[model samples]
Target: GAGVSQSPRYKVAKRGQDVALRCDPISGHVSLFWYQQALGQGPEFLTYFQNEAQLDKSGLPSDRFFAERPEGSVSTLKIQRTQQEDSAVYLCASSLALGGEMAGYTFGSGTRLTVV
Candidate 1:
């Protein structure tokens, strides 16, 4: 893809339902990231992967959250047993290299999940 892409632009999940958000990054990008954003708050980093290797996942809120880049080109974020507190916009981003310039990441439009 020319830029990052995310699916299910909007979702309304009943409490306790599991949800999966997908991301497709620009071709050949090496670094990918996932973030969570609550209304009125900035995006918070959830995970990062370099190629097929997951380099960091310290920001995930709990064991209920997981992210992966199975082939390194696409990624998925899964949240189990969705809760009202889990409602937020999930963003995905990709970059050619690791940290250098803050503007290097190309972010996806995000998947807005609402747990009711």
Candidate 2:
């Protein structure tokens, strides 16, 4: 893909349901990141993967949130037992550099998950 692509641009999940969001990053991108963005706020880092290794997951809000990039190209973020407070826009980004900040990032439009 020419840019980062996210699936199910909008998602509605019932409370307690599990949801999985997918991201297809640009070819050859080595750094993949997941972020949670609440309404009226900037995106908050959730996790980061260098290649296929998950190097940083401390930013994830809770154990219910998990992210992985098994093949180093596509990634998935899964949320279990969704809650009202969990409703937010999930953003996926990819960068050519190991430290994403240095190379900037290409972000997907994001998946808007609304819990009800």
Overall lDDT per candidate, in order of appearance: 0.93, 0.93
Name the runs in model 1 displaced over 4 angstroms: 100-103
Could you tell me the lDDT of residue 21 within candidate 2? 99
Error of 2 at 96 (Å): 0.4
Show model 2 residue runs off by greater than 4 Å. Answer: 101-103
> Looking at model 1, how many pairs of residues clash?
0
Q: After superposition, how far is residue 105 of candidate 1 from its true place, in Å?
A: 0.6
**Model 2 C-alpha lDDT per residue in residues 17-103, reported as the tens digit of each score:** 999999999999998999999999999999999889999999999999988888888999999999999999999999998666676
RMSD of each: 1.2, 1.1
Residue 3, candidate 2: C-alpha displacement in angstroms: 0.7
